[model samples]
Target: MIALVGLGLGYMTPTVVFDTFGIVSDTTGGAVPSAYVLALVVMALTATSYGKLVSVFPSAGSAYTYVREAMHPNLGFMVGWSSLLDYLLLPMVNALIVKLYVEQVFPTVPSWLVVVVYTVCTTTLVAITMRGTSRVNLVLLAAAITVMAVFVVIASYQLLQGEGAGTLVSTRAFAGPETTLPLVLTGATVVCFSFIGFDAVTMYAEEAKTPRTLPRAIMLTVLLGGGIFLVAAYVTQLRFPTNAPFGEFTDDPLPQIGHLVGGPLFQALLVGAAFVATVASGLASHASVARMLLVMGRNGALPGRGLRWINPRTHTPVVNIIIVGAVCLLAVDFSLELISACINFGALVAFTFVNASVIAHFAVRRRELRTAGEWVRNAIVPGVATLMTVLLWTQLHSDALIAGGVWAAIGLTYLLVYTRGLRRPMASLEE
Candidate 1:
């Protein structure tokens, strides 16, 4: 339950919820609500496939472990390598969004300073101990969910009172005059980033008390989180309406909406909640990326000993935490669009492989399941998810494709050199 809630709340960050309005609007010509709905459907299917994989493996490494066990170690290495872009850079992206929000409230402060302070603080919190970080995450998650609830109530009331759109019910948010299938798909691709953390639940299998129940937890997280996202997007879109371009308020739309519905005080409160939420998200991302690094290191897929080093006192991978922090410093130089695109690219690629891993595990390799339900769960469901993700992948920005391709090339090069042209097993480092 803790993992599910954390993954749900952390992935549904204020930046994602608010900023996505503009991103989808720009692409789909104001079909923000429809984009979110489509994205949710796709995510639900993908999450179902993820659940099947977790039931079989019940282990860490997420997509890496699933692919390695079901397919080949080399393919798993590629997945892990691609995943590095998602897990390692996600904290940096969160930190950057936090800095942007801070800049909105205090325009006089230097952005670079905000980035430095937030990066240091988040990294310190994560490096201390997993137990401490988890506790802090729960508190922050509660706060964020409360803030979102407040927004929904206030926004709905405002709409009922004929404030923004002067009507409670409208179809413009869902199917605007300019809406098209391609545009909605494009928006769906971008909105897919909002669901990135669902897979992180599988990475916690080793720590779960009842490992067999993880599949249920993964599906529940997606359903619960998707519900929150759909409501948030719908109400916010109604408050702003289809005619208003979210681009003008992209830097900080939630607070802008907060000010609109309540007042300056409410706006300030929402901003504070957003900061806390970003920190919570950064903490989770930091811990997850560190664990992935530790797993790879222990398996000899990475620089062993260094990343695998766990602090005896805190029982945390301190070295990997520090490395993540160092990588966050690069966030100061990149734009939010570039960072988000690259991260989304890697996550979608990894998700594609995970869906494929399910097929490899149940239908092709094991061939143990003979019933219709088993085939639907193990083959048909994942096949649909694979098609959806690949379609979404094609909709990604050119920059994302180029960056992901370069990263994949680097991983292939390493595999060739490390495995001696695939003659020996890729786990050569473990020996």
Candidate 2:
């Protein structure tokens, strides 16, 4: 549910939610589709390794569990810490997006009030998350899917009417910004966030009704989500003039697109969809991150013993969920610039560790494996993806790098204290 909220609607319809971040053909230099395709390819290789790991070790911690089993315990701890960095910081970006849309509807409202309101809404949702995951997520999913469908209808209808021809372009003519490689890489890093949620399915391995069926679901979701996003991006570009500043479209790109192609109703629906989409992301991020923390706690990586406490009534990790919620609310107070930068920094680190985990797993099993084709899935693909993530990290701001470094430092400090005090020998490989 949380992953669905985060990556489902707005990810594909980035034009509707975060148009300022440069994921569309017009703003990103006509290479939005290609960027997504590239992301898909990167994830596909990683996903193959992920599929094997998840099937063999279907646990709640997702990637961390895989890393712990396949590699050194300290490496697992690092990946778990990195996963927390990704989840905790991403809500800052989401909250900023929410604040922008809120300010759009009530332009006279103070920006601080918008931030406060967004923080409150996300926190309230987090509070409710401790109660149970079912009721709230069901409602959010319904609303998100409905809003997406409405936009699709409105956008498709407008296209049928032969309006906004200048804004839309043929796929053959698509050429993204012919800028310097660094600039393009920076933009591509931003674009990559849209494709991050397909892995969320692995996190829910424990709750899956049919665990074996999940690999197919993950693949299907990625393909379907990617395809829909491609169409949405093209249609959005066709409707809105490309030259508009990203800041102008940050609040409600769909309404602007609606105004250009259709009318007021479409605009209203688009705003509604954007809000629902943001809500979905917040919820999913909440759930997934909390689970990662719980897994970390269970293995003694984190200090709090109570982090593993599960609610008997709700069957949820109450303490972890509350902590994640509080952190996300804090993120709302931050500037969007910081939030976006933080997300890239955290995710890149986690992706790097995940690729390393895959490589280690394949190496350990190489002698046992008879198949000649295992190298690409286990070794070569993971290597390239890891390099790509590390390269992307180089393009991030120094502040983000510093912030991520600080976070890692803090985690390492905590781990060091725990290990020394307990005499656990954590840095050394554990049998």
Using lDDT, give the best candidate's number: 1
TM-score of each: 0.95, 0.83
Residue lDDT tens for model 1, 1-431: 76555765675564467755665666788778898898888888888888888887777898888888788998899898998898888889887877777766788998888888888888888888776887788788889889889888888888898877766578877877788999999888888877778888877888889887788888787887788888888887777765354346664465566676778898898888887888888888888898899989889888658888989988899999999999888767786767777888888888899899888888898884699898898888889989998998899889989998999899889888988998765672232
All models, RMSD in angstroms: 1.9, 3.9
Clashes of each: 0, 11
Worst window of 10 by summed lDDT in candidate 1: 243-252
Pairs in steric clash, model 1: none
What lDDT score is found at residue 301 in candidate 2?
A: 69
How many pairs of residues in model 1 come into backbone collision?
0
Name the top TM-score candidate.
1
Model 1 whole-model lDDT (C-alpha atoms): 0.81
Which segments of candidate 1 are over 4 A away from where they belong?
242-247, 428-431
Per-residue lDDT tens digits of candidate 2, residues 1-431? 43333333323333332344333344356455555555566666556666667777777676667776777666677667776787776555566666766666667877666666776676556545533443454465567667656665676666566754433345532344463345556655665566666666677777776777666656665666666555665555454435463445543344455444446676566667666666666666666677777777766667687787887766677787767656655644575555566676766776777777777777555443456567666777778988887887787767878988898888788777867854664543222
Model 2 residue 425 lDDT? Answer: 42
User: Would you list the C-alpha lDDT of every candidate in the order shown?
Assistant: 0.81, 0.61
